[model samples]
Target chain A: MAEILARTVEVTRKYGDVTALDQVSLDIRAGEVVGLLGPNGAGKSTLVNLFAGLRKPTSGRVELLGGSPTDPARRRGIGVTPQETGLPPTLRVGECADFVAAHFPDPVGRGELLDRFGLGDLAKRQIGGLSGGQKRRLAVALAFIGRPRLVFLDEPTTGLDVEARRTLWDGIRRFHAEGGTVVLTSHYLEEIEALAERVVVIGGGRVLTDDTMDAVRGLVGIRRVTLTASGLPELTGVLGVEQEGTRTHLLTADSDALVRELVLSGAPFADLEIRPTSLEEAFLTITGRESQAA
Target chain B: MSLVLTHARYQFLETVRVPIAVIGSAFFPAMAMLFFVVPFAGDNAVASTYATGSMVIFAVMSACLFTYGIGVAEDRAQPWDPYLRTLPAGPVPRFTGRIITVMGLTLIAIIPVLVIAAVLTEATVTVPQLLLGLGAILVGSLPFTLMGLSIGYTFSSKAAIVIAQVVFFPTAVGGGLLTGDPAYAPEFIKIVSPYLPTRGAVELVWAATTDFTPNPLALIMLAVWVVVFAALAVWAYRRDEGRRFT
Candidate 1:
């Protein structure tokens, strides 16, 4: 019910004979972290392009901040990082950051931004001299330069190392905690699991499911509860029961409730392990797009 | 103004980082002056003066066409241009900034030729003519600038390079730039030079710096080229935008 920062009203975008986006509609509200999960060619980038005012829908309307996405005034409050970006190789990192910063009315200071992205040491180095990961860090860093209310990051940590990915995650977390809405797309399920509270599964240019993180995970994966119990009569009637040598395994959608029932029944159990479903398992099941992207 | 200047400054920094780019633009004109003008017409005040103006126009034409045509096409392939285009500010400021940067390079490109003409040749011009020639140089460079933008937006970088080279040499030669004297020009050149934009551009520069009378027909043709290039530039921009983004 919060103010809608951006929305697509049955927007359809086409390129020649192919329809990149169908009559898909979505709304991104203020102060929300939404994850767009999909494989390659799922129209995730196409949809983000519409939100960022980079493209126009062929038929239905695309709106941003209560105006057309193409409007310059509305873009003042939005930030975006595309999937594949090649920074100007000759400009030094600090100079590049400052150049982008100058476009906004109230941009973050160059020095502070450098420090935040761990790019301080590379400040004087030309972008061409930096490693691929360093260049990606700079690209993502530019998105936050304008102190925007909403951000659209398309595969932000694609080429980053684990260490750099963690650092960027920290920055994203800090930004979100400071009341900035984030809309991110990623191939890595862990990335979505780490950041997004709401998940939208997109496949074939359609929204398959849009729900809370827990609910989406519940769809494709059945949580497994393993325990070693002696004389466990109550567990006999449970669904998906597999009896190992001295241990019992129960796979169910509601692991929390099953555990609580066991505890309330005064069953003697040792080493109870409740493992929630992994995002990868859920993604493959819900979208059935395993061969498309990493 | 500040934003445009910032764009210009950054663009300048980006290009100057590659020293060869600066060297390349200045090389041809200086070489033309040294080999063609200084040796043959250095002693003749009238011939050297007109040749000097023609070289200046030559430098301007190369700087605007190759720099914008190839540079814009190459930049279009990069991610930075799209990011900039999607910003809150429109492309006008950036376009103007790029033009200023290219003009700055054009001015620098002409300097070596000018210096060679002054030191080696007897090119004579009054103070008023000198200032007028500078003004004329900038104005005459307009059609070429637009032409560069048109070619750049219309083709890919590799294609742009080929297209620019294909169109450049013949136009320059057919326009009678290297022929020196009108009466001595090839029969084919004399017939076609009045219609080419380069002929009008170099004609204006010659009239500004020497005692040469401006050709009315060439001036009118030059105006027509300006309108044509302007229209092409606009068409290229809209087509590029609609094709890429929409």
Candidate 2:
């Protein structure tokens, strides 16, 4: 098992009357890409902020590199790119990179870092004149400049185009391939699927599920069976049912059992199709159940 | 030390690239020299010398207040500030960096006033007097710097700008910067002037450059203001840090 690089032990953080995180505990291990999948206002950013030392837990504790997150020495081993950031408008891209790099003990070369993010050609451009996507890429690139063992990126590719997002993902992948640990939060399920080996789903300031990608898939394991039918009797093994005009759709964890029941019931149906549901449907199911329970 | 310089260099670059920000602090003092001093007191060696000292203080006060106060507040308003705070260098390097940047800008701001005094007015000083006057300007700027830092850390950028402006004119007037010398100004100003930090600042410059006697009361008050403002600045900074980052 990999060593734990960062951890939040029963951490609870509040902003006056609102609780951003409630007894949320998580561990990020070395050389693993962990995805924090949550909807907006679900304490994803708050968790990242605590680990990055930008905020303190109202209770419990946050540790980074085996020490208190607030300590400067421990902070040096980690890097973070927040959801929103503004660079010095008048500064050139190269200068901005240098400024952040100077804070770290061993920083990556400026040109190499820029090239990794596809920003090599923009070294001389002032941040104010760069396109929004370009500025975002630069901001994310700076996080890697420090050569940190652990990196936390909160919504790293928000507001970026598909091409720009891919470029950023490649950069992140390269870092992970080099044995770097990463914890990134994103609502984009595909982003999590593409990068994360471990998945931690959060909702309503609580962890709905924490498991490997394959294990989480098995947990949801829902399959959608659609057919054109009328007045169909309710079937066993069905978790949910939806009617669209003459077509009926059934959601079930066991598609084989549901199919067997459907055939035995002698339901008059046509165009019968059964397929595995996407992760989107599973996430909705998990989060929806959480909200209802709360 | 290198970290401090790196932070200072970048911060200086950030501000100097915007030419208007540089010109804003120097405008009023240079204009005052032109409109009031050059036309009226330009020929009187003693009066012109005293007026020059007051305007230099005026320049220093504005530069310190606006540069540190509004600049810091505006930086806090940006997402970049929070990001920078998260870095591992702690606050000392950044704070020292900002002070260095402000000192450089302050020197730039006083140039226009100095040029006007040297060229159009009868303001004369030996080399030693000039050097001492420069040292006095640096010393005089301390209280304003602390006051500006307090306002900056305590308020948002919008409120900070208004507060700095509101504080600017009253100190200039009450300290007798615009009245040539407090002893010759209205009786009310004479009584109040010694208590203003600006009065102590200008008096130091006057004593440094001319035969004028420095007021013991004004100097004492200046020291008091520095201590008080230092405490307030620290409180404001700690309060802001606790509220935002814990």
Candidate 3:
């Protein structure tokens, strides 16, 4: 069994009258990547901050590495990349890592980190001079500098190009492969779909759903399937049937039985394929939040 | 302590690197003392006293106002506070580091200004008296430094600059540095002035130049100001720490 690295129970945070997080609980295990998904003002950032010990919950307890979250030793084992790129603009990439690394007992070498992030050429350049993508990469590099056992990445790939995002995804996978736990928050559904083994959906300061990607999609249910035939075969139990482009698309929870029926009917169909409902559709159906572009 | 020193060194370098702040706080005051005080070389003992006093206040103001005010804002703009808080040594070291850097920078500015004032105004004071004046000036600046800390933490960057100016000019004027009208100043002003950092600085310089003793009442008042301002700074810092992640 994987070790439980971080856990929170009934966590609630309030800023005066505004509730940022309410009764949120989560468990993250070693060597696993958990995606935290939410719309704007959905308490995603608040949850990440509480886990990182950057913010304290008003009414909950958090444990990091089996110790109090506030302990500096526990914090050293967890790295956080905040939503805002909190880098010193004037400091060079190398200097930024060096400064943060100074706090740790045995940090990874600067050259290794830069090389891993493909920032070798930009090491000597000031952060202000870096492009947005480069700055984002630098923040990610800094997060891993301490060789932390658990990492919290808040929108880690916000400004990256497609290739850079892929590179980061690979790096996260590598980190998890080495038995490091990662909690990631991203607006990109595909990023979560590709990375996270288990996903947690938050909305309005509360958790709407927490399950594996397949389970979440299952909750939304497969899109109803429809098939067309010339003889007008009896299809009484079908969920819904729609005609389009001179053929019928069957809408049903069971695609296999419908396809078997169509094959038995011997319909002159040119195209047929199984289509799974996307996580985005599932997210919209479950949370009822505004539909976001995939 | 070492961690605090590290932060202090960084703060010191950052302050010195800013050209506008360096010129305003250190360079301009030295120039002002040279051009204004040097030309009128005569038996004008009162003008000489005022010049010497004002130069010291100028140094303290530069340290407490420009350095801490701007430095704290810039530090907050980045992840410095969170980063520092994550360190093993905690926030006390960071605060100490800043205080040490401020004190060092104040001394650097004050010494040169004092030398220029002495040469230009032909002010006479022995080495022992000068050392005593330096001690008084260092002690007197604590309240103002704490005041600057409170201002830096309490306001946004733009508001901090405005607040610094608002505090700077009145303190300079009411403390008998610019106007030299302690008598004509209001009774409340006279009573409050001697307790201000500028007032303590001025008293130190005045005593050094004229071989006079400082009033025990002034020292007590300065001490009170230091304690109150220090409390305000701590309160502001704790409140800021709570909201940093927001």
| Cα-based TM-score, every candidate | 0.86, 0.88, 0.80
Off by more than 4 A, model 1: A82-85, A222-294
Q: Report the Cα interface RMSD of each model, rounded to 1 decimal.
A: 1.7, 1.6, 2.8
Which residue runs does candidate 2 get wrong by more than 4 Å? A82-85, A159-164, A218-285, A291-294, B242-246
Better of 1 and 2 by lDDT: 2
Best candidate, TM-score: 2
Error of 1 at B90 (Å): 0.7
Candidate 1 C-alpha lDDT tens digits along A1-294 = 799988999988889988888889998988889999876787888898888777778889998888987888889899877333578889999999898888899999999998899988889998889888888888888899999999998788998889999989989999999989999999887898899999888876778778998877666456778999977756432445678998987766677788888888897899999886454434444454333332
What would the per-residue lDDT of candidate 1 be over residues B1-246, giving only the tens digit for each residue? 888998999999999999899999999999988999998989988888888888888888888889999999998887777788667777677888988998889988998998898899999888899888888888889899999999999999999999999988888888888888665778999899999989899888888888788889999999999999989988897678635643
Candidate scoring better on DockQ of 1 and 2:
2
| Candidate 1 pairs with clashing backbones | none
DockQ of each: 0.40, 0.51, 0.24
Give per-residue lDDT, candidate 1, residue A86: 71
Q: Can you give the lDDT of residue B40 in candidate 2?
A: 88
Better of 1 and 2 by TM-score: 2
lDDT of each candidate versus the true structure? 0.84, 0.86, 0.73
